[model samples]
Target: MSWITQKLPDVLFIQEGPGIRKYEYEENGYPMINVRCVQDGYIDMSSARCASMELATTKWKHFQVDEGDILYTISGTIGRSAIVKEADLPLLMNTSVVRFKSLTPDLDPKFVYYYFKTDLFIDELLGHSTGTAIKNVGPSHLKKMDISYPSLEEQKRIVAILDQAFTHIDKARALTEQNLRNVRELFESYLQQVFSLIGDRYVEEALDDACELITCGVAATPKYVDESEGVPFLSAQNVKSGKVVLDKYRHISKDLHAKLTKKNMPKKGDILYSRVGAGFGEAAVVEHEFEFSVYVSLTLIQPIEAKLDSYYLKYLLNSPQIKSLARSSITSSGVPNLNVKSVRKFLITYPALQKQKSVVRSIELMESEIGNLESIYQNKLLELDTLKKSLLQKAFSGELTKNMGEAAA
Candidate 1:
């Protein structure tokens, strides 16, 4: 087998999109391909913005994206590539996404696109990239990068093998993803069933009447200190997956914590509810008796031990119905907020304390089972990804065709 190596620009033409201003976007027109549109292997135009024909023909006349062009994201979330098809026509490129075309007939675009999937290519691309937080690579950087390929015929053969292999791998991946979704849905469905199908022994009460206290945390920002010298501070971000995660928490001076906790101290069994921003409606139970001061973004709920189970209330708040009600009541004037008044007015349905404990146990058991299944499926997905990279490595290393020839012999 013979292979040729050259700089990317020597065999491919690379161009990125012009910066389209906010005012230029219209209700409907040519699909403007942004960085988001380029998925792993194909372009998804569902969320694409539009530019008018006037802009496409005038200022952006030469920026039209054609079929057979390979699109690569050159900015944040770099290294994703896709091939444009007929259905993706009349498309125009937006900033940060670059299109590549085969400058020579000897090179296959699909071959180069597949190479973009390899770790070798990604490592090289990142080596040429710049920036600390958000990495970026330009067409000039891509122009200087090297690409190695066999003859066009061999390239097509390798591409054919990859396409067939990936088709099966992708299908398996889709099914595994669906299974993961189903497991999560099962938990959610059971929660809905448990909450909705209440027995005659159950009673409904307002949250204000059920809990001893329903108040938010400190409003004023506190002075910061080193982790070893200060008290742990909890915020909405600390509450996730139905538990308080202190792994990435910040620290406040002990005096500030003392002042803050006087008004709002989180204790074991207290439920921390996210009140604003993206994490709103998420609730978690404080399982440990750790000293922590909460941020204003978190609402602390102290359930009356005799009346309500803290775990039960935590699960109830996270239920789909309660979440829906919370969404409806959220004040979106600024950040989406779940005010104390709104939370107090929420309806709480429960059975006897014994029954509540039983329900909690059942839900916890089911959650554990679902978590195990999720781990299995997640591992399967990782294995599939590894398999793909393995196949790409073999194909490019010439071992794939060599193995095929030996099998034929």
Candidate 2:
């Protein structure tokens, strides 16, 4: 910035967006582009609202966007920017957004647009942003944002390099994301197939037939336990589909935990199923020996002697079939729920205990394979993101062009 500002033709002017009101918005009028319309380096106007012509001409006529102008979000989702195109002209903006127009021909707007995507600009914006909950930046804060550039031709060269790199990176990312989704869907389809019986060996029975007891968790809310003097308290949030997330834990005193679970202690090989709200039917096998007390939002299932394996019950509870059954039995109107009766009466089709174990083993193997692939793709995505940041740093520090020059030599 020190070097680039030294050769400036004119100080950059920053303008605030028009303070358009909700009343000024209409179903059909002059198109008004807000922050939502600015996405992925382009303006998406398919869902953009409109303002009455009278309001646009009378109050916001001066705020109309033109080709080459840069629109930046200043509140809520801060620092996202997009360069205006010819088709984007004559659109009005609200106060949540701002516009930046170069006063000199020396600076290339396209190059500047890429700069905003860099960590340098984002760090600066965060430093100047004000607000406890929702951060904001006004024109004054934007004016202080430091931006450096090389000659126009050099800027164009950098933009060209980044553009090519981004295209390749984006394509790889999309493919990886799709592959991840495919693996998940494959697991789901396999689950449905395994549960869908083909032979007479398997018989359909109520969920109660396979379990000794299906009971709800503690009805009374336990007193809040201090971190040092309490045991982990499990709730619906801790039980995810086919897994238990113990990351964010709340604790209750050992005395309270004792009284809460005096009826039945949740132990290893037990299946814990969420019975209420958004996580209804999601279940996890108790793999850990750690002491924990569950809330009323969860149900503790005690499998009968040799009828069901805990792992099989966990997977069955997570299957689409079980979820559909649970939905059908939801007696509450306001909040979704799978009550004790629903759990006891829920239908299940199963074969011998050995067959259930075989299915469980197969599912675990598939889960492990999918998990490995997911990790690989996730790590690759992280690497690509890091690569982008590195490229931006090199481009700004002249290292990119220096390497290009050396290659030419």
Per-candidate TM equals 0.91, 0.75
Q: Which candidate is the best by lDDT?
A: 1
Backbone clash tally (model 1): 0
**lDDT by residue for model 2 over 111-145, one digit each (tens)?**
88888788878888889999988988888777766
Each model's lDDT comes to 0.88, 0.80
> What's every prediction's RMSD, in angstroms?
2.9, 5.0
Worst 10 residues of 2 by lDDT: 1-10
Supply every candidate's count of residue pairs whose N, Cα or C atoms clash at under 3 angstroms. 0, 0
| 242-309: candidate 1 lDDT, tens digit per residue | 88888888899999888777865778999999998987999999888779888889999999999999
Itemize residue pairs with steric clashes in candidate 2: none
